[model samples]
Target: MTAKQRVIRVSTEQPTYAVTVLGTEISIDVNGFIPRGATSFDVRGTSGLRVYVIYNPKLVTKPIGAVRWPLNSEVEVIVASNDPSSVVNDNKVRVSYYGPTGETLIANAWLYLTCMAISLDADTSRTGVVESTANNKTKWTWGPHGEGAILLVNCDRDGPSSGNLDNAYPSVRSYEDLQDMSLMILSTQGPAGVFDSHKLLLHISMFDAGKVRVFHVNGNTSLSSYEHVLGSDKLSYAVKRSDGKARHSFFVEGLAFPDADFAGLVSLNATLLEQPSQDLPATPVFTDTVVFRVAPWLMTPNTLKPVEMFVCSIVRGQNTNQKFLEAIKILAKEANCKLTICPEVENRGDRWIQDEMEFGYVEAPHKSFPVVFDSPRNRGLKEFPFKMILGPDFGYVTREPKNGRISSLDSFGNLDISPPVTVKGKEYPLGRILIGSSFPGSGTRRMAKVVRDFLYAQKVQSPVELYSDWLTVGHVDEFLTFVPAPDRKGFRLLLASPLACLKLFKEKQKEGYGGAALFEGLGRVGRITLDEILADEYLRSDSRYVQSCIDWNRNILKRELGLSERDIVDIPQLFTLEHSSATALFPDMVNMLVLGKRLGIPKPFGPIIHGRCCLEEEVCRLLEPLGLTCTFIDDFFSYHVLSGEVHCGTNVCREPFSFHWWNILP
Candidate 1:
């Protein structure tokens, strides 16, 4: 019976000695020479033009010198006569084949060559090797022990005469040249039994650095015709079928003034491909991603920013100072910004909904419900109204209990304001708030502890604790605030300097202006001379003690808050005994309000009556170096008479910043 030609893969546990080719069961012997699995080796079809097999050298106990196939067929395989002495180690065994019309054909084994030609024919002869420069016919060489080799197909009926060939195959001209061959094969014949050689190597040469190259490996070919695709718009590529290294080159450059994405975060996406074909679609291997990020510059403080608007509370009869409110309203209108009054309706506002109740809550929501209020009154806690906070993203405000509160402890009245402090070259939110150890373990220190905890959670530096038991109100606003510097990015600490105030008072006295007028309009107190009031021991003692507190806090500010002596701009004013309470006039400027770049100060009734330069002029003069425009409101009856200044009467929600809070958090 004549045998039909077929390609097959074979794997064996022992060294292949001989293989019996037959339509029925064929067999092999470990010792190498017989057919055992069937009664007789009868070839019904021709098999083995190419062979793929698995046989590890380490697994073989003995080598069966040769692999031969005994068959009855017209088809045959004639290997090169001058091949290696021992085919035991050679993974592939290539040979020639003859069709029905006597045409010669050559084929290679799959991963490893086991054996080709199921039946051997007698008329086997050698054909001389022919060299050519045409696309169809090309020169070729073999790897070590014929490990990697290719099958050549000739268009002519009669194959060339065979002879010794060159040492190695020349480098592939370009990646496109190799890709062209693949596309031709895929279009003419489908992928089934075609080119199964695992050792097929396509040597690609990269021409340009930025151009993308795609490759397709062993792909799905279940249908009669098969195709795959992968494409990229930018610089992207995929190498799906490459085991050895290839030559490559890349060139890149950077420009000093190139347009770029100003948005801090950027994302990049890319797709990789392998062995692209012109007719067949490219194969998709994988999708990759890359990310780039840059942090933003620090946010400028409100004092340094242009006014966007003014935020205030409209709680009637609770803390309203009509003159102070009207002045702020006029200033907002002049500045062309919105005046946001809380509660919308009159007398319906929460008492703690005022600006001072919540400090710098500008970021998108960072914490959750049942938040702290930091006030003796619970205003913003219950409703959490949008009008009260101004910004949708709100932070927790600390609240002090009304029933069992410690008498010496001061409320959020002092905790909310934080002077901008610079650290590690970056300015953080609420850089430094002054705390007091005067009421340690009491609500005063408790409030400080809460503020410290909150600030730390927000990744801000902790507060600097100062002695506040000396002050009558035990608050920082009465003595200090931060204001914009003339031509800088930072703020200057506006301090109520008693010494500076004394100097100004003496200068006024020398001009025949008596000190008695400084005590007028001070809430109808009993008659008392300036000398009589100054001689009181309590007044003298309180003045000296408060001055010491200011001095001590000033040093703490310099040390912890990163301030210099030059950064401290003193406001002149003197502490006076007001019947039973103590107060100051000129230095009360520290408690002033900032309306954009303008400074809203209270016209000191005492200083004006005592024949000093107008309080407005004096303040503007003192702050000229720092670039402050002063507006003196007649606040004698509304604010100064009530133990409070402009700040206590009004609150402001400053313009929002450019940076997102989440991006800067630790």
Candidate 2:
């Protein structure tokens, strides 16, 4: 692409000269340089320079070596220099006017030219490769073939004494915070006086000013040396060049994510402004632009290694979750993961920690960190993520519905992500995001549009909506989860199969254990025998309906995640209808906490046959060969009876995928 030309009107009445950039063109007024009575004119320039006299409407015509102008046609004069001037006024273009003879010079005008080189560059290649010669940096593209610079949301707090995210405050708090931003280099090479006469301005559009901030680094080692140059209310900054360096580097940090209105693409430009006179305003002589697309927030699947675990503990009550917390503590210790327990005073009886928030992360070529996305449920744990999790390298983000309306499907439990997979020939290295919504055209409960739009805007983890409105809690975790595997796509999708549970029960009845009762030791709940469970027609009908609902999503997962039957594990589970929505009949086994090779599952007190619970044994047989440990925690009283299970009461923050998101084709 050609650089925009700076139009300059040359006057013969005064000493005419102009300083310009090498690659940029200057439009000159030919008639203004003509003398009062001259009828003909000739234009010439230095040896290596070209002066274009455009006669045709289209500027595609070739340049002529000689030019003699009389009155043949209207013309436009353009001056271009391919190389920078070694010294000021060394290259000159002159226009001489003559009588009708065309040989006798009546008057002459001289325009002395000095050229310089200036450019602003970043990782415009979109491959995380920075090239100083990169051009066309103003536009951005998407997909594997896309090209544009990438900027990270400086949402992590790098300073130990900071009270908020690094992006929340404009000033750089520490040297570490600068590492998370993208680097932009401004290079200027010319005579020293040219810079003094012209002003270098760094500017951003007012609309994008709040989305990003630019900082000029004066020193390498100290936080005090970083200067906040452009952001927020500041649209433009006059860059000082007192030190006279050839190259100046500025760090660009993203402050917000791509949402409903923002496309995530932002541009910053360095402009060289020249003042024609003290009385006239400054005009831009040249400009170099660079675009950056902010990194999207990405989710971490259970297949990834767990780095930290969050759970809520109830101090006093019959429904206290102390036992559940203890079990998680042991599991966390075994998994070598950090554990955080939110006390009852903070959670206020809300034990569904998983529903409150989801842990994900944002990444750039320079840095990355975990960011917790808080659900708009505004429940007891609403303040938990912001007040506790958002600190010292951790980030927080949330989206609330504009209509002030939200459903159970809006909970984070309805928000899950698949392990990395390639469907057909397309690769999803960051995996696909799974969100619960009503079936198409059903007009039933669905996730809010605002939240859905936010997730979809992320681009990388293309979201897949599943049919989850059939459940009472309306959460995908009530029926499906993923666990790490030693082979076959590195993970196994565990789905709650009512058909599998019925088959197991029928097999046990045939084995002459029909009289064995479920919930054998629980006092608060009544027991039901295997024979009685199989005999209830309404229960059977409900199980079939629930199975069909799960099967609908099962097919979607198969197609979207590129999974075969071997990639899925069917855990024994049954659902019963309540108020036209399905709820777990016993503790849900599929809603388990996954920590690498270990899993904390809810104790489904199935009928004990041959000295063991068949439910537990069946789960072990299905998963043990794949190197997964199953420890059933008793969540029956604390969570199961309350319409939740192990996974609902706890949330896990896992390590980010090793593959950079920018490497993926969305």
Candidate 3:
């Protein structure tokens, strides 16, 4: 019989037998050897050993001491030892059977035992909860009962000299890169000679070997002491105990993300192998497994604090935004945020920086960093994210369509996220992702399938699609945005409302401002009075249709983000239909740059009433109550005339959420 067998059979003919007991339970079968007509039995063992006689397995509770063994039951044995056995078979357990008469002895058997302790552990309990004992370490689940270690993708560039993500290269570049990996420990305690005769192999499945890499940390604090042990090229590694230390630690780093074909969960095992003879093959005596789930990429919302702002400089073309750039520089200083200006030579006249990429992040218990998600628009600013933004501690990831087909809807401006919310008693701690697409079943225009699949696979922020194909540019930012608020959900959903603008104009006409002209003091554009604007029947009908489109998305936001009417702020705006698609009648006010308490809005140049532009006055009145400052910026000729506005021309990288993504129940 091998030492790995759980059941030890004993008879009167063979009473003495040696068995190696690890940190697991062993059952001793005494059914065949016990005499007939015996009513009960007694089990006795050494001080460090625990012995239990189970009469009825169904009724078995945690026995306090040696219990009576009736017919058709078994004996369970456990050995607890802090040190290894100094002598061979030093521990013993005896089982005595008695007949119906209490004084009569029927039969008895003795079992000799040798104990050893071995375990492999990781953060398999609560995130910060660590323990050395081997309990629930193999299986991994989700929710409140979830238990497993979390692994980061290690996609950040930790070494400035390396010019690539740390995961791309197998060799360690710096100590900071090592900090991004998860920790695993192997512990063994027993007679040294037993380990010499046995082999300990650290192995991973061929499927998982490519997903993770393990490194052995020798008993020193130097770069050369770390050795790469197992990864894509190697499936199993023989663990060396030459240092004579009872404990060893290994660092594990994830190389790939959880894609469509991969489930994100990986397991590694440490097995103790034993060879019975020279001619026999080695067999596994005990195996301890620890599981890890790769972390997902997450998006940040505008409500978060802005760490940096990105804008492109245009100085060559007739559509140069020199004045808008100056305005943004002052706003950046007011917000105390760092400003990064992409020169004209690098941008190649593509001023739409916001459409090129979106800022997000990836996190693990060990390390976290901001990751820029490049869109597949492939415009003039396509290389900006990878060449300029990706550097030390910054990551870059992108998804391109297989057929190389893309539309204006693939731009990053069509992407957005809401602040955290609770819907129908379910809390989305990371909020929800919002994407713009055609109406259901329209199948006209949509974001690329590869990009959508990648966002859905994140599992934290469940994405909600809204209809934006009605717009010529086809971006969600043109009609909707979010701003920080002092009350009510910690933020407010800002939606462009053509109906609100029409009502404001009619109220102005009633108050004897009917002759107030829009585009005042502007030479390039013609001035139109409020009375004339209200008289245009086609314009009124187009504004009604635009209201319906905004209303559709408003209702969706209410349901998906658990928002109400009070949580939404409507900004006065109008749209004119051209070729059956809507375009902003004036500079779109909702498409504005949000910097903490300050907002840089596109000046609508609406009719001036009593020495104040009614459009600017209306926006200030709605937002100022929530402790916000609005600055009207003139992007009329440079941006608005070109079919974009303030938000489309700029991008912001905000701080990540305080809550860890791993804690979410996905």
- How close is every model to the real structure, measured as TM-score? 0.48, 0.89, 0.89
Off by over 4 Å in 3: 1-5, 8-22, 30-44, 57-90, 93-112, 125-130, 139-146, 242-245
Q: What lDDT would each prediction earn against the true structure?
A: 0.39, 0.86, 0.83
User: For model 2, how does the per-residue alpha-carbon lDDT over 41-72 read when each residue is reduced to its tens digit?
Assistant: 67788975778676764533333553456633
Model 1: lowest-lDDT 10 consecutive positions: 250-259
- Segments in model 2 whose C-alpha atoms lie over 4 Å from true places: 1-4, 7-15, 26-87, 95-109, 125-131, 143-146, 159-162, 195-197, 218-225, 241-246, 441-444
Write the number of the candidate with greater TM-score, choosing between 1 and 2: 2
Give lDDT: candidate 1, residue 439.
36
Local accuracy of candidate 1 as per-residue lDDT tens digits, 276-359: 345565443222222212111122234645434333444366345555667878877765666655442522443323323533
Q: Where in model 1 is the C-alpha error above 4 Å?
A: 1-301, 304-320, 343-356, 359-376, 379-410, 416-430, 435-445, 448-451, 519-537, 576-587, 609-617, 657-666
Candidate 3 lDDT over 103-180, as tens digits, reads 577777788766656677877765543467636777777666667788888877777743777888777778988878
The residue-level lDDT of candidate 1 at 590 comes to 79
What 10-residue stretch in candidate 3 is worst by lDDT? Answer: 74-83
Per-residue lDDT, model 3, residue 53, is 45
What lDDT score goes with residue 220 in model 2?
A: 70
